[model samples]
Target: MVHVYTGDTMIETTEEHPFWVEEKGWVLAGELNEGDVLRLKSGENVKVTKLERVDLKEPVKVYNFEVQDWHTYYVSDINVLVHNKAARYNTPTPVNPKRVDTNYLKKNGIDPHSLKYDTLGDGADISKYNIYVDKNGELWILKNGSKEFIPTYESIGR
Candidate 1:
């Protein structure tokens, strides 16, 4: 952990390490957050262990190297894989921002249908097409295998 002096007291923080998430790609150690899913070199998604900052002291040497045909590498002896900030096109990996509508669910018959929940507690997982109210009271429909506020849904039938 890195120690920083903030005027009078020292604060501990995790070092800014690089990570390559398959969904978003090249996220900072701090930006990874507590519950964000981290991507593995083996094409698997896993949760991060910790995101606190740690100092490596003064006169730190940084290395910059690349493995041909790949944008990720191992940083520690324990095989802590890290991803570069940019992909082949000088951009992060792209995620197809798809919006699967309720019609799709009905046509496919994705059951245990929990889309029309009666109460907040009865809502299905956020990854599904479950409606939820935010602290600000805005309604949202989260798509399957997703964790974002998928805006818009046909008004609930009476």
Candidate 2:
């Protein structure tokens, strides 16, 4: 964690290192408060200049990255239909054709339904999946097979 001195008070950076830009708005993480601390990769401690809760109603372009920004949504707020280590054929029957609506997941080359495991084409292991939340409040659908983030967003019905 990096420390930033603002006049007299020294603040400790928060858990997630999220960056915010005014023109593009907050991109990496969730809403930030005034006193919240952030540490940039450059080792500079940044304090939130303003308070904002981002709502990713649609896709927005920020920092040359076309990313989804969610302001009003929280991970817990979304009812995750499935989770770790469950048998695919048992319930929720992993939707085929992989109709996901996320951008980051698609970029990482993950096919949730037709997901291949062990190169034997032996379906996929549900235990290998993980969920991650970005600074922009966007949720990630990831497979543990690779170290990269998936860029596809499957359509999770409302």
Winner by TM-score: 1
Instruction: Note the Cα lDDT for every prediction shown.
Output: 0.40, 0.33
**Candidate 1 lDDT for residue 36:** 55
The candidate 1 region of ten consecutive residues with least summed lDDT is 115-124
Candidate 1, residues 38-79, lDDT tens digits: the string is 433343345554444654567566555655433445443223
Lowest-lDDT window of 10 residues in candidate 2? 73-82
lDDT of 2 at 9: 44
TM-scores for every predicted model: 0.38, 0.20
Per-residue lDDT over 56-108 for candidate 2, one digit per residue giving the tens place of the 0 to 100 score: 56855432222332211111211111112112112121222232333644565
